[model samples]
Target chain A: MSKVLVADFGTGNLHSVMTAIQVVSSGSEVEASRSARKIRMADRLILPGQGAIGTWMSELQDDNVRQAVNEAVRTKPVLGICLGLQALYEHSEEDGGVEGLKVLAGRVERFSDGLNDCGHRIKIPHMGWSKVHQTCQHPLWSGIPQDTRFYFVHSYFARSDRDSEVAAVADYGLEFTCAAARENLFAVQFHPEKSRRQGLRLLTNFLNWNGEV
Target chain B: MPLAKRIIPCLDVDEGRVVKGVKFVNIRDAGDPVEVARMYDRQGADELAFLDITASSSNRETILHIVEAVANQVFIPLTVGGGVRTVDNIRSLLNVGADKISINTSAVERPEFIEEAAGRFGSQCIVVAVDARRVPDTNPPAWEVYTHGGRKPRGLDAVEWAKRMCDVGAGEILLTSMDRDGTKIGFDLELTRAVSSAVPVPVIASGGVGELSHLADGIEFGWADAVLAASIFHFGEYTIAQAKEHMKGRGIEVCEIIDEFE
Candidate 1:
């Protein structure tokens, strides 16, 4: 049976990630764990984070999950969501410039304060559903159509240095990299746990993947 | 396209079952909350709200179980409210997979709870629900805040309460018009506009969404960031797609649904 470990860094909602994994892949054993030993033993790792960047970084340090996460990403499949995706970058401007894990060569930047395409002033959190355009073929996007709407709630987004690592792009004020993949690591800015059927499909794909590029 | 206006389906739960009633009386069992939530998720609902109308101490565990069950099946944002008086209560709900927690009576009892909860958890996870009624025969014809499921009048002005909630760090306001609720008219446009413009945060217009056009009115005229409905979606009157289509026709930018099943 596939064993999936959802690494809990003590910030944001991790329950939804565990529940979604359980529902989508019933045969797999899913555990929302903070223990480094449990994380290392799992076949797949899900790094889920939320809230302020500096606070999440401090909690990750306090829990000593950084080494465990790095080892897991090198040896097995790793998926990041929301702040999890943000943490994979080099740094973030949130909370006065907090440093990230630097797993991916990119920086997280906040959306510019302005109006949207329709000339209506949008909220900062960008809380709602939006379309995600698949930029390339990836196993995670299997069975899900291009430009499917996914639920997003965040003020900052990722900017990758290498364009090829961008698996999907979404438009808010402008097109931004919403999903990134490098070797065994895949991450998304949207909450797949809250994206409905399409989200479930993505989780199912992740469960079936074999840690390939 | 702009950020799509959200369409939320609210489920009023009593002892683990979805129930609906007029003014919180003569309640009728609708269905299981999990099944209803799963159906709405499949129907392309943007989010789901579960309100424990019976917020009795004995039923607290039951609501949590319902939330857990729904969270397992529904892959969407779930907001749980009622009987959430303390930070521990919010923690318990979030631990069970709730994305947001709505506070009404408790917030009205202690306005500082809004700041405390928002401070502990980010404001994005805290929702302030305000149930208001339009008071006629007054010089300005203002709205009064009601607590205890709209049974008690707190005498707080609705617009001012919304502003205070925002100032205290409420991410969004779920403004429900008691007079328009269950009356099948529409949202209180004036109240919605007043609160939406008063705060920098988003406003979710609730109550009295009778038809598809009413949903559009909530965004176009009421200036709501999201429109919430119950009876119409709970029954077979209309679907979320129909509402989105109507809103799109009215020049509102709605999230496009790419039906993969078809």
Candidate 2:
């Protein structure tokens, strides 16, 4: 049995998230831990978090999950949701300043005033159900159809110019990165678990993906 | 660019359990909130809204237990409503991981609720749910907005009420046709277009939806941001994948579906 580690320290939807994976892969072992550890025992790792970056960082520190996550990401499929994805970046300006896992070469920041200048036509926090624009080719989108609408709930978005890492995007007040991935690490700004069946297919695809380029 | 139509599955929960069917009379076992949520999570449901149906009058606990349980298991965004009358309720739901909260009866009975909730939670977190029934097209004709699950009529024009809600900071509107709900004869497209055009906030066309094509009509022709239905999904008439496929073929942009099963 391929063990899938779902790292949870009282953040976002950890159980429903595990249920999503379980639905696709029959049943995989779900371990909710504040301190990430023992990746050798699992085939993949899921990093799920919901809430502000500052709070998540504090929680991680309180439980010492940072180093354990870094060690596991070295040779595992790690997926992050909402703040979980943000935590993997270099840093965030959510509250004062908080440094992230920085496993990837990028930075997460808040959306700034674009050409419109009035800020985003959409309200701040960019919450709601919006559609995503597929910007790149990645196996995570395998069975997924084009121009699909995914559930999104967030105010700040990640800013990455790596080009190669961005997998999908959505336009609210402006076009922003919705999905990003690198090697064994994959992250989406949108919540796939909350997105229903299409999202489930994405999870199923991820579990069996094999990271085909 | 035309906004893509959304196929949403709504779960009406009573005391943490999901109930379904027309006029809400023939309620059947729709599965545990978390268990059913897992299935929809896999089905690629565009969005899921859980309505407590009686959370208000009963003054029962806001049913955050299911929210906690379901949010823990599902990855997609979750919007919760039903008896959500105050900003604290919205705060509690969001703190518990709900992406958004829907407000109904409260908004009509007291328009201030819309402004207050939107001001405190940000317009994005507030959704105004309206139940409208067509009451013959007179000089102005008229559509009455029903509150308390169609038990009481607010005696307000549906279009006017929608405009008022938007003006007061409603980020989105969940509009349902009382006559068409559960019948699945098709969506009240006429009503959908009116509400969508009247407000800037995204409008979710609810009440009646029979087929995937109906979903297309709701978004394309009806101009709704999302389409909500229960019977089809509850009875297994069409899966979210099939509905999305139908929409995609019609040149609609749907979220990607990673098909690993086939």
Name the candidate that leads on lDDT. Answer: 1
Kindly report the docking quality category of candidate 1: medium
DockQ per candidate, 2 decimals: 0.58, 0.16
Considering just the first chain, candidate 2 attains a TM-score of 0.87
Q: Candidate 2 lDDT (Cα, whole model)?
A: 0.73
Measured by TM-score, the strongest candidate is 1
Which DockQ value does candidate 1 get?
Answer: 0.58
The estimated TM-scores of all candidates read 0.91, 0.65
Question: Per-residue lDDT for A134-154 in model 1, tens only?
Answer: 998999999998888889988
Among these predicted structures, which one has the highest DockQ? 1
lDDT of 2 by residue, B44-117 (tens): 77567888876854434546878878776676667888888777787778766677789888898789988987
Candidate 1 lDDT at A15 equals 85
